[model samples]
Target: MTREYKRNGNVNLFACFQPLAGWRHMELTLSRTKIDFAKQMKNLVDIYFRSADVILWIVDNLNIHNPAAMG
Candidate 1:
């Protein structure tokens, strides 16, 4: 006998953390498109770290995490 499997939609997680500041932000998005990645970055820059002179990010090798995606 074989067992059947069920599947559901996917949710992408975009998490940002500032360990020194003890701050964090997490977004749950339906798709992991370039636009979504851009939005997340925009939120980080325009809202979260607006006053910082420079912001550094450590990201995985996701296709959407590249510089081209910010366009």
Candidate 2:
């Protein structure tokens, strides 16, 4: 699933994909600004993917792309 939202002058775009018959999961999120991306990625990793082993992230060539962004 994909979703987009704007609040307090920030734009957020996110996608969540789940495997059909396994425990695999992937999530992607893009924000109009780097700060929003950092905040959202932190929340997502902490809440939904804390125990994940292999995380596959597909992100754009934005300046905010950081290794610390993923759990």
Candidate 3:
């Protein structure tokens, strides 16, 4: 049997993609908690679409991806 390596910490990359615009924004965090995800999303939106009337974002089915996190 092979030995298993366990890690206590992990890095997460939060990214937003705009296919039509050919652009993306990314943020790295040590944890993928709700607060961290929300902060990353807010930063990206504030930097890229602050002046826009509406912005649409798509994301995978992550545990932290929910309305509570966004709020």
Candidate number of the best TM-score: 1
Model 2: lowest-lDDT 10 consecutive positions: 21-30
The residue pairs found clashing in candidate 2 are: none
Candidate 2 achieves a global lDDT of 0.61
Report the number of clashing residue pairs per model. Answer: 0, 0, 0
Residue-by-residue lDDT tens digits, candidate 3, 10-58: 8998877888989877778888899998887787768778888988778
Ranking by lDDT: 1, 3, 2
lDDT of every predicted structure (CA atoms): 0.94, 0.61, 0.84
- Tens-digit lDDT track for model 2 on 1-71? 98988676544465455565454444444445566666666755787778978666677777667765433
Which candidate has the top score in lDDT?
A: 1
Per-candidate TM-scores read 0.90, 0.47, 0.77
Better of 1 and 3 by TM-score: 1
TM-score of 2: 0.47
Tens digits of lDDT, candidate 1, 14-68: 9999999999999999999999999999999999999989999999998888889
Off by over 4 Å in 3: 1-8
RMSD of each: 1.4, 8.8, 2.0
Better of 1 and 3 by lDDT: 1
